[model samples]
Target: MEALGDRESWAAVVKEEEEEEEEEEEEGDSANNIGDAIASTDDEDALKRRISAHPLYGKLVEMHLDCLKVSVMGDVAGDLDHHETRYQQQPKDCNKYPQKMLHQSDLDHFMEAYCVALSKLREAMEEPQQKSMAFISSMHSQLQEMSAIPIAHSNAPAHPLPPPTSSSGK
Candidate 1:
């Protein structure tokens, strides 16, 4: 009788373990379904997540910013630390650049030029612009004045930017 009772208890234990495993699998499937639904809702967000997950994302961001700086201000030295390619921590020198410092027209013009170059580069590289756009939007949001950069205006004309002319005439 005791042996039979032990057998019955072991069967009950096995059943409970199987039930727990099934519940855990169900929970995992539900979580995956939720994730898939969310991902499907916003493809851009999913692209951003994947881009940021890349091991060299930080380096890519820094390099992109450096290229942007060059596009904006020409290739002058001393803006970034050489070893780490990090921006230098210099005190703001508004007096030195009174007319040129973050003027709306200049910012608009430079950014437009940069966008043209970026599009060309994207085409040459044969990579989708969604990844680059995600990085750019993220960087733009980090700027101190949100209005410094322009998003599209409803009334604005959708025209392709002209090729940027070199001031150096090169």
Candidate 2:
């Protein structure tokens, strides 16, 4: 038989095998939701539809983060920069809660969306720069076709006039 090993070596290997899969399983409510969600999925499309339809608290989540940011970053910024200095230097009140923005993952999603929009805009702009009216017209036609389906904010019309403010408005 060629099945020989040192006693210490065999013991060490056995010890490692015993110590495998150390992840603590999350028990209770968290596991319940995950199990239920997975069980409910019929197919890929169904899974996607269910996931998107799952009650999204994105705005509420954003508001909560904004509140936390205001308490933390706001205090720090106030000490670092006075109202006058902040306005003079940055001009935007978004500094009050410096991190009142998307989470890293959310920012990644937003950046992807931004790149898509930017590419479309650049493509549109490139048409006229192509030195051919026909190409420009074709690009313009493609944009018009896209605009017809209408994006979210675009579908909603802006108010014809701005509302009168307390201090000033013509």
Segments of candidate 2 deviating more than 4 angstroms: 1-90, 98-104, 133-170
Residue-wise lDDT of candidate 1 within 26-102, one digit each (tens)?
99999999998888779777455544444333445555654544443333434543523533333334444334333
* Worst-scoring 10-residue span by lDDT in model 2: 51-60
For residues 12-87, what per-residue lDDT tens digits would candidate 2 score against the true structure? 8888766653323344556887877777665656545333332232332333333333334546646544533443
Ten-residue region with minimum lDDT total, candidate 1: 83-92
Error of 1 at 28 (Å): 1.5
True-vs-predicted CA distance for residue 17, candidate 1, Å: 1.0
Candidate 1, superposed: residue stretches over 4 Å from native: 43-170
In Å, residue 101's CA in model 2 sits off its true spot by 3.2
Residue 122 shift from truth in candidate 2, angstroms: 2.0
Query: Top TM-score: which candidate number?
Result: 1
- Residue 39 error, candidate 1, Å: 1.7
Alpha carbon lDDT at 170, candidate 1 = 70
Each candidate: what lDDT?
0.59, 0.51
